[model samples]
Target chain A: MDTVISAEDLTKKFGDFTAVDRISFEVFQGEIFGFLGANGAGKTTAMKMLTGLLRPTSGQAQVAGFDVYRQPELIKQHIGYMSQRFSLYEDLTVRENIEFYGGIYGLTFKEIRRKIPQLLHELGLLEVERQLVKSLPLGWKQRLAFSIALIHEPRIVFLDEPTGGVDPITRRQFWETIYQSAAMGVTIFVTTHYMDEAEYCHRVSMMAQGKIAALGPPKQLKQAFQAQSMDEIFLSIARGAK
Target chain B: MRTIFFILRKEFRQIFRHRVMLPMIFLMPIIQLLILSNAADFEVRNIYLHVVDRDLSPASRRLIGQFAASRHFVLTQTSFSAELGFRDLEANDADLVLEIPADFEKKLLRENEASLHLNVNAINATKAGLGQAYASAIIRDFNNNLRMEWLDMPDRQNPGRFDITHSFWFNPDLNYKAFMVPGILVMLVTLVGLFLAGINVVKEKEIGTIEQINVTPIHKSQFIVGKLLPFWIIANIELGMGLAFGKLVFHIPIAGSLWVVFGFAAIYLLVVLGMGLLISTVTETQQQSMFIAYFVLVVFIMMSGLFTPIESMPGWAQKVTWFNPIAYFVDVMRMVLLKGSGWYEIRQHVYAMLAMALAINTLAVLNYRKVGA
Candidate 1:
């Protein structure tokens, strides 16, 4: 397997508060690597470092063979990010939003024109392509945002609570989309609090209080903890931290 | 370059798609400019005056006639007692009271001069000052008329008279609309450009779309340029509309080259747009940016010499105007439109604006790093 992301003792501090401590992890290409943590467990900060949105206070990280400290711009070109807040322009039409992102990533006009129809078809949004994004339901908007993130065909896609506040059926479709992308050899580094979602990942890393407490496949973690389910394993880890 | 174009297209689409945006940007400001040009007039007329003529002589009667003859003062009441005339002023029935002394004609003949008591209501200081000036000017004219009547007498001592009449140059008619429309146009353009650009970036922060853009490979300069061009274009279009209204409706002359005026506007808008971006740097939401921009803009517009003359301001306030870009534009617009000032006359302003544009835009771009990206 190919290692697409590698971090060693990456840390971020805001004054005396450590948002993300000296943490180390490696995400391989074409695998669903779940980053599980409770709220304020430093998952978002760690992901920000990997996505090149933030600089580490200490230590190092390599995203798609580009150094986080030295070549954050190049790293940005190789990774796609979907933040938790549904990052599509609400006032713009769905097609315009996709075109905007495509242009930002330096896609040619001909390429953008060709990709729009196919993207809309994949998301089953061809009927509402011209509708304003604000008029769309939350689930459809989230899906469209995700599809736009992949327009550049980046090697790795970072999903930070991508399914938050989405309906359960759309959440299933969202997971199906993630699975399809992973099947096509695109690495998925996702952060979620749902233990059931963690069980679906090839491997999961649980963080507590700015530090990773456990790292392994869910079944292995469950067996090691002598727990019946991934939820119990996460509870035991969180309880041990407290 | 094509990337900037796409961003521009998206921005334009979003701005026009808002249902209230077209009217708010184009219609409302134009309406306000039309109304304010007529409403914010400096021409003060029809000041109410009360007359107290104790002499009851031909001199006093003719003096009262002169006050009634002029266009500025309206003789609202006539009384014999000074106390009665002052009571009219107190009741707000009169703006001023003019009292001729009982020995008015005798004093002028023996002493070559006579004094009259003129009391003015000092509330609403501008109107009071203007009303007092009008009264003094009429009195001065009456004194000259009496002096001319004495010159008609053969056996009279002819004194040398040095009379000064102010001929208002450039605007000979002293047209209030002509003086103010250009300044009002500058204010409207500043308001549109400043608020639109200021609110735009902070709105992205509030909605969290900035994070998505930060992860893209878009360069900082490219992003800044993309954000700037749309509002710049829209503001220019609004300027064109306002200029048309000023010319067609108000008949305000454009004495200098239109291109020269637009040339200054092009650079001045950079400073204003930079101010908008800078406001976004310290603010977290659209509401905070609005409050800060308005607070800053009120200070800027007041010192911009819109209605009041900057030359008359105090020393410290005048010094503050050196750092104000709106003051420069206000001065430029008036100089170009009213005085036929061309590029050579306004070159120093262009240089100053270029320096400000470079400084402010650099600071704004440096501060706007997607929250320290």
Candidate 2:
């Protein structure tokens, strides 16, 4: 397996408070990696460092074969990002949002035009492609945001609580899309609070107090912790830190 | 470059699609040019006057007629009692009260001098000062006429006198509208820069769209340029329309080359755009941006010599005007429009504004961080 993302004791500190401690991890290409942590456990901060949106205070990291410290802009060209919030332009229509992102990422107008029909069809937004994004349902907007993040065909897509505030059925459907993207050779590095969803990840890493308490597949982690569910494993790890 | 074009298209689409922006763009310059230009006129006129004619003589009547004949003062009341005229002044019914004593004409013929008591309202200091000046001029004219009629004083009055006649240049009428409309263009462009480029960028930060944009391959300068170019163009168009309106409506003279005015304005707007860019990069919310913009704008406008002459301000305040961005443009507007000044005359201001643009825009670009601090 080819490793696409590698970190060596990546850390970030804001003033006196340490948001992400000296910790390390790796993700193979075309694999689903779940980054699990409780609220304020530094999941979002760690993700920011990896996506070139923040500078690490200490240690080193590499994204898409580019140094996080030296080549963040080059790293930007190879990676896609989605945040917890709805980040698409609310005033812009569905198609304009796609074209805008595609254009900024250096896609030709002909390429964007060819990609729109299939992209909209896959997101089930073909009917409302011309409507303002604010007018779309929340589920549609989320899906469209995810698709727009992948508009440039990035090698690794960072999903930060992408399925947050989504209903259970929609969350499952969103995972199917994530699984499909991974199957097509896109590395999925996602952070979520949903423990059951972590069970679906090929490998899961549980963070507690800015440190990774456990790192393994869900089945192995469940057996190693003697827990029946991934939720129990997270609860035991969080308790052990205290 | 291509990315900037995309962002520019997006910005223009968003600006055009905004419901309030269209109206604000259309009505702001028009309303500012119409209402503010007319409202900001400081020339005092139509003063209400009440008179007490106790003498009831030809001289006293002639004095009253002189006051009435002048366009500045309106004769509101004329009575035999000085107390009645004072009451009118006290009741706010009259701006000034003139009381002629019973021996006013008798003393003038006997002693060649008679004192006329005048009461003036000083509530509005400018109006009061100007009104007093106009009244004194009329009185001085009446005194000169009275002396000219005295045949006995001919040898005394025959002494050589230095006569001074002054004529106003550029705008000979000294029309306030001609001056105000050009100043109004400065104000209009400033508002567009502050609210559009400044507030608009902060709004993206407020709505979390900037987070998405930051992660893209777009460069920081590209984003700032995209935000600035659209509003910069819009402000210039508004200025052009405002200048045309000034010519058509207020008949303000455009004595200098339009190219010089626009050239100075083009550079001046970079200073303003840099300010807006700096403001947006430092602030995170539209409200905070607005507060800062208002704070800067109020001080800059007040110190800009827009409403009052900068020379009239205290020494420290006049020194402060050197740093005020709007002051340079206000002076440029008046200089180019009213004085028919060419580039050589306004070159110093252009150099100052260019230095300001370089310093401010460099600061803005430096302050803008695509990554988190």
Candidate 3:
């Protein structure tokens, strides 16, 4: 498998405090890679570094085969980012949001017009395309945000706690969209607090205090720890830290 | 460029969706322009006067008659003594007191140099000054007629030869409304641009939408440009409406080219919008941004030489106004609309506005953060 993202000794600091310590990891193409951590455990900092939104204190990172430091714009062009706070314009309709994001990615009007219906249908948002985003349900808004992020057909999609505060049924539906994207050869890099969601990932990395304490496929990690499920394994590691 | 267009479209949508803000943004300025123009006139009218004529002579009566004949002043009451006139003034019933001493006609005939004491209320100095000038002119004319009758010479020293032809060059009548309408227009546009733009991005921060945009591939400069463009357009539209009202309703002449006024307005809008962006960048909440913007705008408007001449201010205050962009635009607008000044006459103000625009915009762009700090 081709490595889509590579980070070596990545660190980020604000003032004298380090947020993301010397961390290294790799994400391959077409796999659902899960990033799990407690709040303020440096998951956001690491994701920011990989997405080229932030500069690392002293590290080397490459995304989509482009250097994060010297080629951030190139990396930006190839990856999609959906933030924890849904980024869609609340005052605009779904179609307008799609066109806006597509335009920002340098997509032509003809291309955007052709892709709008198919994209809306795929996300099950065709009926509400004319409604303002603010009027939509939170679950629907999250789904629409994800769809807008991928409107440019980016190679790797980053979902930063995309399903936080969403109901289980909606989260399952959201994961189904992610699965569909992954099946279409799009790599998914997601962060979540839910251990059940981690089970769906091809591999999972649990961060503890700015360092990756555990990294393996969910099944392998469960067997290695002799746990019944990913949830039990996460509980054992969290208790060990305490 | 396409990104900027999208951002601008979204901004317009947001502005339209909010019901209360929409009327304030579009309708308030027009209403103020209509109502305040009439209230702001500097030409004093229906000025109440109290006359204390002790002489009881025909000449004294004629002098009082002259005051009554003038359209600007009205002889509202006749007092028996100066004390009564003072009482009238204290009661706010009279603005001026004309005191005629006893034996005034006899003294004038004998000495040809008899004087009349005139007391004027000096509070609200502008009205006081105008009243004094009008009363002095009437008294002088009455004296001239008395001199003519006493001398009995048809061709005595010619008053025409000594006349000072003081002509108001641009505004021939010195219409105060003509001057104020343009100035108030500048105030309205600057207030809207600075306050609205100031709170816009900060409101997003308070609501947590800023974080979403920060992570997008959109460049920082692009975002800043997009945010300010809608406000810039709105300000210009307001300017156009103000100019139209000035010409049609007030009959204030557009002495200079309309295009010249638009060009200066466009450059000045950038400076004001940059101030808004800078305020948004520093503030975290909408209310804080509004308060800060209001404070800065109050200082700018007062110091902009709109209500009062900058030259009349103390030297230090005048020096401070040199840094105010609104001062330059107000001067430019008045010069263009009233004085009929061309580009050559207004080049200095134009250059000053451009420089302020460039400096503030560069500072705003530099201070704007694309990612969370």
Candidate 4:
């Protein structure tokens, strides 16, 4: 398979402190790659560097065939990012939010108009299309946010803990959306603390103290560590780091 | 170009959708412009005077009559003892006390000179000073009249008197509202543009939406221009509303071309809104942005020559006004509204505003970063 993202010795330093230490990894085309870490393991920092939202202090990385240091703008054009906060304009209506994101990605007015009904129908939000986002339930908002993030049809989509605070059933439903997107040959790079979600990823990388502790498929990682489940694998790795 | 339009459209939708913000934007400025213009008037009138006449002669009676006849002075009390007038001054009932010496007419005819004690209460310095000036002017006019009558000149109307006629131009009646309404309109527009633009970006940061936008492919200049243009349009609309209120309610004449006022305003708002965006870039929280904008705006408005004339300010203080964007607008507003000044008369102010608009917007654009550190 073709490689969509590749990084070597990626590091980020703020003053005297290093946030993301020499972490290295590669993401393949149409593959669901899970980036796992405990809190403060520099997962978000690494994600930022990958999406061109931030620059690395000393590293060699490429995203969508563009260098992160020199061609960040080009990298930005090819990737979609959804933060842990579920980035959607809470004040705007659902239809307006879709059009806004579509427009920001260079879609014309006529194009946005054509895409709106289809997007609302796909998200099962046709009835509430005119409703303000702030009035929607958390589950609906999260689903809408995911759909809007993918509006530009970028080469890769990054989900930074896309399901942070939600019921299990909604989260399971959200995973189905990710699976479908991945099935359509859209690469998914996601970060999560939920072990069950990690098991769903084709491959998972566990980060500890700004370093990659493990990288492999869930079953392979479980068998190699002699653990029964992904939770035990993460706990053992975290304890070993300490 | 298309990206900027989308941003602008989104911003307009968000601003109008906010229920509380919508009314506050339109109503607050109109109400403030109406009420504050009346309060901002510097015209002082109705000085209360306590007169103590020691001389019961006709001369002393004539002087007291003159003070009573003057429109500015209200004869609050008449007393024989200076102590009574001094007591009135202490009670804040009287602004000034006029004491005529005994035999004041006898001394004026015999010695050709007579002095009277004018005791003034210096509390509320501006009122007291103005009261004293009005009192002195009445007395001088009375002296001139008495000289003409006493000399018994053949030509009573032309008694070698040099009449220095005071002519008030522009606002012939010296209406304070005409002067302050335009300045207030400028202030309201500046405030709306500055504070609104300042709070907008910081609010996005606080709510974590900025990260989503930063990851998009939009250019920084396109983003800044998009954010600024909507507010610029809203502020100008508010200015139009204020101008209508000034004209219909206050009857302030628009002496110059209305287009000139609008042209200056369009450019001036760029500087003010750019200041707001610049403050937002430096601050992480909306509260911090509010405080910083408040601090800078207070300094700017106070020195903007809105109520006080810049010519009356000290040389050093006046020099500092050259850098204040609000000062330029206030100057332009007054010149265009009251003096009917055309482009040629107000070109210096326009040039200053253009330079400020360029410098401030450029600095703000440079300071705003689409990427995180």
Candidate 5:
């Protein structure tokens, strides 16, 4: 696999506090890379620095063949970001949101018109295309947001807690969407607090207190930690963090 | 340009879709223009008067009759003591007290000159000043009449008093509403412009949509222009409606060409809306943006001289009005609507606003960050 994201001792500090400490990692193309951390474990911070949404205090990172700091605009053009807060204009109708996001990604009107029916048909959202996003259920909205983020069809897609607050059945279905994108040779960088979801990744890096405490395949990590499941592995690591 | 168009389309859709916002955007300004214009008048009338006549002679009685006859003053009471007249003034029953001294007719007949004292309520200073001028004029007219009748001076055909004939130019009737409607129209446009532009980007930030946009390849300048353009267009439309209401309802005359008024409004919106965008860039949430926008607007409106003349403010405050964008617009509207000032007459205000627009917009765009939240 080709290495798509390369980081060397990435760090970010806010005034006196360090949000993301000196941590380094690499992500290969067409692989599901899981970034697992607690609520304040700096997972989002590290992801921001890698995605060029934040400037690193020290060290350097290259994303999609562009430097994070010097070529942030270039990096932005090539990546799709679905933020933790579920970014979609709730007042806008489903079709309008698609058109807007598609437009912002430099998609032509013809291209967007061609993609809309296909996208809606694929997501089973064709029936409610004109309905406001605020009226949609939580599961459908999340699914639509994810699809909209991928509408640009960039090489890499970053999902920040994309399945948060959804039902377990919907979460399982959401994983299927992720697997489908990965099968299409799109690199996936996902951050989640769920241990079971972490098992779905090809490789996982666990962060604690602004630093990565462990990095390996989920199976190997569980085996190395002498834990029966990913949950125990995370619990044991979290215990050691204290 | 395409990106800006996309953003602009999205903004317009959102604004039109909001139920509460749609009504507020139109009705609030209309209501304010029709209703508040009436309440904001500064014309003083129906002054209450209490007269204390110490002399029972015909001269003093005739003098009292002159004040009673004038339409501006209403003789509310008659008092024998100056103390009681002062008490009525302090109690808010009377605005002025006319006190004639004892032996006033005897002094006027023998010595040929007599003086009367006037005690005026000065709490509302402008009202007091106008009332005093009316009283003094009536007294002067009375003195002239007495000189012509009692003195029998055919040789001195002209009285020695310097007859200063007052001529009011524009707004000759001094209709306060005419002076206020134009300034109020400017306020209506600004309220729409500043508050809308101020909260727009910050609302996106609060909702986490701004983070999504920040990671896009869209340029900051494109975003700033896109954000400001929608509100700019809406505010101008609001200004037009307000001006129409001012004309039809309040009967305000538009002296200068309508194009000149709109031209000034367009440039002035750039400055005010740019400041609003600047506020949004630094603020993280809509609430913060509202507070900062309101604080700046209060200072702006007070210094704008919409209700009070900027010249009447102290030196430092007047100097500060030179930087206020609202002040320039208010001045332009008044000069054009009341004085029929053309573009050449308002060229200085236009140039000042252009410089302000450029400086404020450049700084706002520079301060907007694509990264680091």
Candidate 6:
């Protein structure tokens, strides 16, 4: 399979501190790649570099066959992103938010009209299309945000802790959407703190203090650490002093 | 361009949906236009005068009547003693005092020259000077009449032999309301456009929606254009309403083309909205944005000659007014509305406003950070 994302010695620094140390990784097409880290473990910084939102201070990264530094605009056109926070406009209705994001991706009005029904139906959001996003529950907003992110049908979707404050059942449902997208030959590069959700990925890279501490499938990571579960494997690897 | 349109539509929808901001956006300008136009007058009229006529003579009475007959002064109170008139001045009930000598026209007849005591309150010294000048003119006219009566001539046009005629071009009547209404309209546009646009983006930053846009495929210029266009339209609508009120309610004349006023308003709105975007780019919170905007606006409005004449300001201050877009717009509106100035007369001001708009927008876009990090 072709590599959808490849970062060669990716690094980022802010003034005196290194937020993302030199690290390299690859994500194949249609693979759900989980980036697991603690609060300040540089997961967000790395993902930002990949999405062309921030320039890497050193080394290089490519997404959808475009250099991150030189071709950031072209890279942006083929990728979708959802932040950890509720990023949809609360005052706008669900359908309006979809239309806005779709428009930003350069989708024509006719294309947006064609995509809205299918997107809404898949997210189970057709009934609440007219409601303000603020009035919806957190779980539903998360789903809506994800749906909006994928409005342009990009090749890769970068989700930074997409299910941070959601409930367990809603999180399970959200993963179902992620899995469904991955099955359709779209790569998923997700960052999360939840170990159970990390287990759902095809491969995982656990980061600690701006460095990649471990990288493998969930079961392989567990076996390599001689642990019972992915949770123990994460704690054992992350607990050691940097 | 298409992305900008989308953003603009979203912003407009949000502004329209918010019930509280809608009234504030429309009503505040109208109310300010009504109150400020009335309050912000340069022509001093109906000045309260306290008179102490100890002489109780016909000459003194006639002199006092001259002041009263002139529409500028009203004899609010009269006292037999100077001490009583001073008391009234202290109480703020009177603005000026005219004290007549007790000799009862004896000095004028004997010496052929007499002087009356004129005491004026110095607080709000500008108004006091005007009041004193008006009183002095009245006394001079009375003296001239007395000289004519004593000579028993048909006309005493021997010595001075000069006629001075003054004419105001734009505002023939020199109505202060006519001068201020258009300037106040410009101020309202600047205040609303800059403050709301600055605070709106800062609110998004505080709420984290700005981060969402920062990471998206949306270009920074597109975002900036989208953010400012709604405010641009709203500001123009406000200009229209203010012009209508000025014409119908205040009886202000619109001597120039309405298109000229609107064209200037359109360019001026961009300058102010760009200023707001610059403020938003530097400030982190909505409160900080508003406070900074207020500080900048106060300076701009003061220097814009909204209340005082720009030409009367110090030379350095007058030079600074050239850069203030509010000054250009105010001057343009007043010239167009009152003077009937055409494109040639106001072309410099129009070009200056356009340059300011372009410069401010360029600076704002340059200062704007495309990436959050």
Candidate 1 off by > 4 Å: B56-58, B84-93, B105-112, B147-151, B154-159, B371-373
Candidate 3 residues A112-170, lDDT tens each?
Answer: 89989998998788998998999999999999889887888888999999999989999
> A18-42 in candidate 5: lDDT tens per residue?
9888999999999999999887889
True contacts kept of each: 0.81, 0.83, 0.40, 0.86, 0.81, 0.63
In terms of DockQ, the best-performing candidate is 2
TM-score, B chain alone, candidates in order:
0.93, 0.94, 0.94, 0.92, 0.93, 0.93
Indicate the docking level reached by candidate 5.
Answer: medium
Worst 10 residues of 4 chain A by lDDT: A77-86
Candidate 3, position A50, lDDT: 83
The DockQ values of the predictions, listed in order, are 0.71, 0.82, 0.39, 0.81, 0.78, 0.61
lDDT of each: 0.90, 0.90, 0.88, 0.90, 0.90, 0.89
- By descending lDDT, how would the candidates be arranged? 5, 4, 2, 1, 6, 3
lDDT tens string, model 5, B83-202? 999999999999999998988888888887899899999999988999999999888888777867788765356656465678777788787889999998888889889999999989
TM-score for every candidate vs. truth? Answer: 0.96, 0.96, 0.88, 0.95, 0.96, 0.94
The residue-by-residue lDDT of candidate 2 on B1-373, one tens digit each, is 9899999999998999999998798677798779999999998889988988899999889988999999899999999887888888888898888889999989988899999888898787787788888888888788778877863556366777446799998779989999888987898888887778889899999998898998998999999989899988998888898899999998999999999989988998899989988999989898889889989988898888899999999999999998888999999999999999999999999999999999999999999998876
Model 4 per-residue lDDT at B256: 90
Report the candidate with higher DockQ, 3 versus 5.
Answer: 5
Q: Give the C-alpha lDDT of model 6.
A: 0.89
Candidate 2 TM-score for chain A: 0.98
Listed per model, the TM-scores of chain A against the true chain A are 0.98, 0.98, 0.97, 0.98, 0.98, 0.98
Which tens-of-lDDT digit does each residue in B254-302 have in candidate 1? 8888899899999999999999999988799999999999998999999
Model 3 chain B weakest lDDT span, ten residues long: B153-162
Shift of residue B301 alpha carbon in model 2, Å: 1.4
Quote fnat for model 4: 0.86
What is the alpha-carbon RMSD of candidate 6 to the true structure? Answer: 2.3
Regions of candidate 3 where Cα sits further than 4 Å from its true position: A219-242, B8-25, B46-65, B68-71, B74-121, B145-161, B203-207
**A1-242 in candidate 1: lDDT tens per residue?**
89999999999998899988899999999999999988888999899988888888998899999999989999999999998987999899899999999999999999999999999999999999999899999999889988888999999999998888877788889899999999999999999877778988999999988998889998899888898998997887788778
Considering only N, C-alpha and C atoms within 3 Å, which residue pairs clash in candidate 5? none
**DockQ, cand. 4:** 0.81
